[model samples]
Target chain A: MKAVGFKKHLMLEEEESLFNFEQAIPEATGHDLLIKIEAIAVNPIDVSVRLNGTETYETPKVLGWDACGIVVAAGSEVSLFEEDDLVFYAGAFDRPGSNAEYQLVDERLVGHAPHGIDIAEIAAMPLTSLTAWESLFEKMRLELEEPSLNQDKTILIINGAGGVGSIATQLAHLAGLHVIATASRPETIAWTKGHGADQTINHRRSMPKQLHELGYENVDYILGLNDIDGHWKEIAEMIKPNGRIVSITRNEQPLDLGLLKSKSAEFMWEWMYTKSYYQLPEMITQHEILEKIAALLEQGRIKSTANQIIDGINAETLKAAHALIETNSSIGKIVLCK
Target chain B: MKAVGFKKHLMLEEEESLFNFEQAIPEATGHDLLIKIEAIAVNPIDVSVRLNGTETYETPKVLGWDACGIVVAAGSEVSLFEEDDLVFYAGAFDRPGSNAEYQLVDERLVGHAPHGIDIAEIAAMPLTSLTAWESLFEKMRLELEEPSLNQDKTILIINGAGGVGSIATQLAHLAGLHVIATASRPETIAWTKGHGADQTINHRRSMPKQLHELGYENVDYILGLNDIDGHWKEIAEMIKPNGRIVSITRNEQPLDLGLLKSKSAEFMWEWMYTKSYYQLPEMITQHEILEKIAALLEQGRIKSTANQIIDGINAETLKAAHALIETNSSIGKIVLCK
Candidate 1:
């Protein structure tokens, strides 16, 4: 099988940062499904892992998470899908990635791909959608089926132009919340509003003042997508009494939790890889969430978030996609197809 | 009205720390109830306000919260209680406290007192029980009525012999979780066991090792009652993946939230006065919770946690009760009666 990989972590401009290589196809065992990769997505996590590693791997480390593929074979213990079924997933952190011709994944983390969508669209939906869904429905405890009950609630999504924010804004709106998302640039603000944001604020400006201008004293929930270090103070100030906040961003310094003490608010972290990395009992919920995402796509309630699609899934194309993701201002997902 | 209050912050042994003073009685208005105090419970908050303040008040500042009393009057907007009804409550932080001969409190924060319990016991329950119930059922999202469904879960209560821990352990036990409470002294351990702890660990020791020796790697939930800065690292390490931790203790330093990131855990602050202080819409829930607490007392499902009772509500008795509460290891609530 042909794979795109790196032996040592390096910048994308380096000659050996990523290379084409040959590796033997892994066997499917113990609920694993062997899938032939058709399309893959480049995320900020892909860029992070490629540049952050300190040790050289004995074998090349393939780095990709979001992919749309077809099941070529299944382990004896597999029960979810049969061979030839198309699937989409954000694979586990510890295993081999999907930037290859074929990959083996746990059936519990895979979902049947939604039809009537392009390969790039399907590939872009899994990772970000899973993260957005889990952060809102699971961590923040939003009522998915009871959207009517959420009519009076408000959610503020920071960095509304990012991958997770794109989906989160849509899902929060679908849950009947009044969505308030933040974006600095005009294009990004328009992009966020197109997704589902009822109102948009600029991250570069005074968010609290802008929020007051929009007639909200405080929000019931906040979903932080990036720059938690910079936005945390505003988040604390904007949350209502007994409100909840969920963040996927890393903080450079310690957060002062005292600001929320008098409000009796809640804080939660949402790491999409936690369930699969720890093999938690609720890991199967990933499959369930992805299935729901597919249904939403099929119903046309949410459109795919893929904005830039590149041809081919080689070292060259992945490096290009990585460069785009590193720019930090990409409006939507960047997908790579084989 | 006669009140035991302090004009300046001072040590408990100081003559001016708590003194008998006279002030005009406050009239009830807008959902307020004027109650004549019968008994009051001395909590650490009373000690805190007495010693932690820097500025002197024109009039002495009263520093009491928990009380069992008879309503002497009601405001036009009051709907929950009638005159002459015996009620128990932890009044708002910004109002005149229950240390006075007569105090005004919001009708929403007051609960109909339960019979069959002594005045001292009833006075000791309102503040601590409200903190415990809000932390467990509301913040942690535990199933309150579905006890059988919670049988498989486990909770750890730090400082199990303290006011909140004593009631939290009992409530968690009644909710059907296996309760592991922490108490260092032999007497406190015995008291905790009697309260509802299935097992006890010493918070002063290596808690993770003790928990492991008790045949558990981690707990599903943790309620922090005191010394959060000292117990934070252990609390983070001993919490299970996707767990919830609630604390009433103030942290002197910032907490390392990164420790719970990969595990996707939740942290919540449980300030019992938040709703009333903020005049939140859910303030009425306190009345409902107290009514339920009264029923539980009537049904003999939970017991009052008063450990010591002192005679009289004068400055001398209040000073003595405050001295006991200032001790680092008071086992249960201490009440002062008139």
Candidate 2:
């Protein structure tokens, strides 16, 4: 099987940063689906993993999380998927990823691809959609089934034009929350508003002041998608009493949790890979969330967040995607397809 | 009106630490109830407030929270209670406290006192009960209405013989959860078992090892009532994936929140005064919770946690109660009554 991987951590400009390699296709075991990769998306995690490690790998580390693929074979214990099924998934972190011709993924993490979406669009939806869905419904404990109860509630999404933020804005809106999203650039602001943000604030400025200017004293919830340490104080100031905040970014410095004592606020971290890494009992909920997202996509209720697509799934294309993400100005997802 | 108060923060042995004083009885305003005090309880917060501040008031500041009293008058906007109603309440933090002949409290924060309980028993309840209730059902997000669903769930309560812990152990047991409480001394262990702990462990030792020895690797919920900084590592290690933890104690040092990142667990602060301090829209829920608590008390579903009572509502009695709390070995609660 052909794969794009690296033996050592290096800058994107280096010749060996990401290189083509060959390996034997792994056989499916219990609950595993052998996937033939069709399309893949690059996220910030990929860049972080690529550049932050120093140890050279014994084998080239294949790195990609989001993928649209066709199942070539299914393990004996697999019940959710079969051969020839078109699926999408954010593969596990500890295993070989989807930047390959052939990969094995747990059936519980795989979802049926939406019928009307292109492969690139399907690839973009899996990782971000699952993150958005779980952050809102599970971590924040929103009642998606009771939109009426959520009608008066509000949510602030920091970095509204980013991959997960774009989907989160849509899901929060669909759940009947008044959405306030933060975006600095004019184009990004417009993009966020188009995707279901009722109002947009500039993250480059004081978010609390921006929210106050928009006539909101505080919000019922906040979904933080970028720069957690930078926006944490504003988030603390802008959350209502007893409000909940969920963040995807890891903080480099220690957070002053004492600031939230009087408000009795809840803080949760949503790492999309947590379930698969811990082998949690509810790992199958990812498949359920993605199925709902796929249905929503087919129904035209939510659009794909794929903003850019490259021609081929190879070392050069992946390197280009990584560079674009490193610039920190990409509005949405960037996908690579074969 | 006769009251016990302090002009400055001082050690308990000081003559001026708590002294008898005279003041004009305050009149009730909007939503306020002027109550004639019957009994009051001393909690850790009282000691915290007394010893942590340097400001000396021109007029001595009264300090007490949990009380069972008679409504001498009601404000014009108050609808929940009228004059002559017997009530139990944990008064607002910013208001003049219950260490007086007369005090004014918002009706929403007061509950109808249980008919079958003594004044000292009812006084011991309000503050600790409210804290325990909010920490479990609200902050931990437990489904208290569906006891059967919670049968398989387990909750670990640290420092289980203290004021809030005693009540929390009972509430968690009543919710059908398997309760594991920590207590070092023989009397405290017996007290916790009598209060509804299914099992007891010694918090004086490594809690994770104790829990593993008791045939448990992780818990579904954790209510932290003691030193959070000391127990944080054990809490992080002993919480199940996606579990919830609520704590009342503020951490003296910054916590390494990254420890729970892979488990995707939740951490929340449960300050009993938060709703009233912030004047949240859901402040009326306190009234509702206490009303239910009153009914439960009448039905004998849960018993009052009052362990000792001192006769007379005066400076010397309050000083004795405060001294008992400062010892940090007192089980349940200490109350003073006229």
By DockQ, who's the top model here? Answer: 1
- How good is the docking of model 2, as DockQ? 0.83
Among incorrect, acceptable, medium and high, the docking class of model 2 is: high
Q: Please report, as a residue range, the 10-residue window in candidate 1 chain A with the lowest summed lDDT.
A: A249-258
Over 4 Å off, model 2: none
DockQ of candidate 1 relative to the true structure: 0.88
Q: How many residue pairs clash (N, CA or C atoms closer than 3 angstroms) in each of the candidate models, in the order given?
A: 0, 0
Q: How do the residues B1-338 of candidate 1 rate in per-residue lDDT, one tens digit apiece?
A: 89988899998778999999999999999999999999999888888888896898988888789999999999999988899999999989898899989999999998999988888889999999999999998999898779998999999999999999888888998999999999998999999999889999998899999999999999999999988888989999999999999999878899888888988999999999999999999999999888888888888999999999998999999888888877778988999999
State the lDDT of candidate 2 residue by residue for B170-225, as single tens digits: 99999999999999999999999999999999888999999999999999999999
Worst 10 residues of 1 chain B by lDDT: B320-329
TM per candidate comes to 0.99, 0.98
